[model samples]
Target: MTLSVALGPDTQESTQTGTVTSTDVLTAPDIPWNLVIWNDPVNLMSYVAYVFRSYFGYSEAKANKLMLEVHKKGRSIVAHGSKEQVEQHAVAMHGYGLWATVEKATGGGDGSGSGKGKGKRG
Candidate 1:
């Protein structure tokens, strides 16, 4: 599978081949986003871990680690994707009674925190 686009004049044509990934979306190029879940008193750690497992299909260990990060570090980035998708994830998190937000993913700048855990922006 391949995708090629010609963006009018003054721009070099781009070609994408093989395993087309989400980040390959030509709309925004290299700028991806993340879904950050904040720790809240109401949701139990067990429930938080459950959310990660059920919603994200994360392994028990990975989910527990992320849950621990939220509990100890105040927050954790649970997933990453485009603005629309991450925003939907945030909303779903809210529906599950967790605090979540979507922000532009930074490569170690703009104070968005480190990109770690099982983010889906690959």
Candidate 2:
């Protein structure tokens, strides 16, 4: 069964009346959080890539890609994990003299979700 409400012309909202049967609860793009790294002028592009490789264990190509992203986009996502883990990564980045922060991901999620780690250098 379903119930619906219309607030505008030819528009409607619907509520389903039934038990869920194991359908996916959320879409892929709605991850809940991320750790975003901002870029600065102090770190060399090569050094930044090296950091990605050494700290995050990213492959040379992947590290370079993320480093390039940090260079071009001024930020990048380095790792993904629980909030606690990402927070630790952020603090670690700080310890490494990198700029880093954790934030809610760009889209909404079901509250139980993953987050990415962030790192930056200037």
Candidate 3:
């Protein structure tokens, strides 16, 4: 007696055969998420910089840069990491009386619809 077997065109045969795999695993992007701080009438500029330095241990120069970005641009991405870490940063900033949020770094669109012109100080 004889037996016959057939395999599909997409099937790959190991030495043992009978294994099936249709797709390859995909990897997520390596970019980190960002924790952003937004300028508000409530928090002083110096306080924002101080929070950056104290919470993230950022250097004075870097903290100042972020502060300036907040002041001029109405928002600045103060930290980058996983979603959990970014959320932690946002919470800490809120505790410090600063307005903060998190977002995927690659998506540059600010979810806040306040508009760029809205934040500009006269």
Q: Give candidates' CA RMSD values in order.
A: 12.7, 15.6, 22.1
Assess each prediction's global lDDT (C-alpha) against the native.
Answer: 0.63, 0.55, 0.57
- lDDT for each residue of candidate 3 in 1-122, tens digit (9 for 90 to 100): 11111111111111121221221331243334567677778788888888877777777887887798778777766665557777887888778888888866543333432211222111
The digit string of per-residue lDDT tens for model 2 on 1-122 reads 11111111110011121221232443443333355667899988888787777887667877787777677767776654446666888998888777898865433444322222122111
Over 4 Å off, model 3: 1-26, 29-31, 108-122
- Scanning candidate 2 in windows of ten residues, the lowest lDDT window is 3-12
Best by TM-score: 1
Task: Pull out the clashing pairs in model 1.
Answer: none
lDDT of 3 at 52: 73
For every model shown, the clashing-pair count is: 0, 4, 0
The order of the candidates by TM-score, greatest first, is 1, 3, 2
The TM-score values for the models, in the order shown, are: 0.67, 0.60, 0.63
Which of 1 and 2 is ahead in TM-score?
A: 1
* Superposed model 2: Cα runs more than 4 Å off: 1-32, 106-122
**Candidate 3: residue pairs that collide:** none
